[model samples]
Target: MRIGILGSGNVAKSLSRGFVARGDEVRLGTRTGSKAQLAAWIAEQHLAIAQGTLEGVTGWAEAIVLAMRGMANPETVRAAGEPAFRGKVVIDATNPLVWRADGFPSLGLPEPESAGARLQKDLPGAKVVKAFNTIGHAHMVRPQFANPPTMFICGDDPTAKTWVTELLRDFGWSSIVDVGGIERSRLLESLCVLWITCGMRLENWNIAMRLEQRI
Candidate 1:
């Protein structure tokens, strides 16, 4: 699989590493196309990931991952161009988090609207799935826990969700829950606030949510 991830941040790097580990060709899209900026990190990690401009990567990839900051979605879309995303499954791994002075974060968007929904609206031609937002980047792939955590995802397109679920399994997830359409992203984004609050209170940054079913 050819994966194009937008952003050069932690989330992008983590996902890129995971995809590469699974024998997928990964390319990271950055604001700048200069490979020199990410060359050192790539060599240090010893991963064969490529770097390119946003538009270039989007055109080259079979699938795209929006790993940019929540607020930067519009700009990212503009930078990558809308037409390039048509018929591609875009994994939205963003949270519309508004950080405050006390170090706590809140949702930037109001009810019934979320980053995932907005992305879907922005890229109507693409299949957008909300995922990888409720967990930390370090534990995104092959997380080790007493019990495997459930990856809750939502999207209007069932096929896209299915694709993401299979990818999650490849990344070592045994349990996955599809929480309905993109509108359900409101709930998942709120879940991120809860995750952050718990991490701050417990002073532990390595926590994940698990749904224990009675089945």
Candidate 2:
């Protein structure tokens, strides 16, 4: 599968490497096509092409990974050309984080909505699946915490969620949990805030959530 990733940050880099390792064609989208470090990293890893704009990357991909800031997704949509994203399986890994003076970090989304839900609404024709937002980028690739950590994925499109589940398995996710449709995205994004606070308060960045199951 050909994967297009928006943003040139750590999450994007880690996922790009993961896809390349899994033998999938990966293209990275960023504001600048030639960031020397990123270019060098891609070359060193022998990963896929890195393009300056979202349209170029999306044009080369069968699916897209939305790794940009939650607040910046709309702009990314405009930059990628809304029509181009139509009917494509867009894996949304963004969290709705709002920089506010609340007791702790909080979400930018409305009380009942999530970043993934907003993306789905904005791109009505596109299939948006919410995945990879609850965990930190460091644990995203080949996670091995002595136990199989759970990855909670949600989407309105069952096929899209299945594709994401398969992709997660390839990246070493042994426990895959479906949290239901696009509406559940709000809950997933909130989990990020909770995780962050726990990490900070406990000084345990390495710790992440997992779902236990038994027969």
Candidate 3:
């Protein structure tokens, strides 16, 4: 599958390399048209990946990953445009985090209360699935723990969730849980905050969560 990741940050770089390593075509999108870091990444992974504006990537790939910072908000989504994302499965890996004066991060949304919810409202034609928010980018792919960590995903469209679950599986997530609809994004994004706080307190980014099931 051809995937377009709309960010220049660590998440975009991580997922881009992971997908390409698994033999999928990848394009990374950022507001800037620069390709310096992306070029280095391509060489490091020993694979080719295209880099372009978010608008360019949206049209070039079969799937899109919303890997940008949540602070960009409506303008960022607007910049990418609706036509580019129409009828596509968008894996939303963003959180609505804003640093407070006290040096703690907090959710920035007011009501419908999640970055994923806002994305769905703005991009009605896109199938938005929320995943990969509760873990660090470093651990997103091929993570090794005593037990495999679970990835929580939610989207309005069941088919879209299934498709994203399969992609998550391919990315080395053995436990992908579909936790209902896009509304669940509020909780999922908060879970990211929890993960961040735990990491800060424990002084370790390697800690991860794995749901234990009695099946």
Candidate 4:
């Protein structure tokens, strides 16, 4: 699989490593069109990944991952060009976060409006799925816990969601829950706030959410 990740940040690097580990060709697309820092980091990590501009990577990838900051979604998509995303599955791993003076985070968007939902609107030609936002990047791939944590995802496209579910499995997630369409991202993004609050209070960044079923 050819995967294009938009952003050179921690989340993009983490997901690139996971994709490469799974034998997928990965590329890091930067919004700034400058690759000096990203190239150095790639060499330092000894990863088999390529770096390019947003538009170039989007055209080259079979699937795309939006790993940029939540507020930068519109700009990133505009730089990448929406036409390039048609017929592709785009994994939205962003959260509309606003930090308080005390350092706590809150959702920037109001009810019924979420990063995932906005991305879907921005790229109507692409299948957008909300995922990888409720947990830390450190535990994104193959999280180790007493019981496997659940990856909750939502999207309007059934095929896209199925593809993302399989990708999650490849990344070592055993339990995945589909919470519904992209609109449900409101709940999922809120879940991130809870996750962060717990981590801050417990002073632990390794925790993940799990769902236990009676069945």
Judged by lDDT against the true structure, how good is candidate 1?
0.94
Candidate 1 ranges beyond 4 A from true positions: 35-37
Model 3 misplaced regions, further than 4 Å: none
Per-residue lDDT tens digits of candidate 2, residues 52-122? 67888877788999999888998888888877888899999998787767556799877897889889998
Clashes of each: 0, 0, 0, 0
lDDT of 3 by residue, 1-215 (tens): 88999998899988887888888998888888567887787778776887888788888889999988886757778888888889999999999898888776778887657899889989999999999999999999888888899999899999999888887888889988888989999989988988988888888999787788998
**Where is model 3 poorest over a 10-residue stretch in terms of lDDT?**
33-42
> Candidate 2 overall Cα lDDT vs. reference?
0.86
lDDT score at residue 153, model 3, on the 0-100 scale:
89
Inter-residue clash pairs, candidate 2: none
Residue 157, model 2: Cα distance from true site in angstroms: 0.6
Cα lDDT tens digits for candidate 4, 127-171: 999999998998899989999999999999999999999999999
- Compute each candidate's TM-score over C-alphas: 0.97, 0.93, 0.95, 0.97
TM-score of 4: 0.97
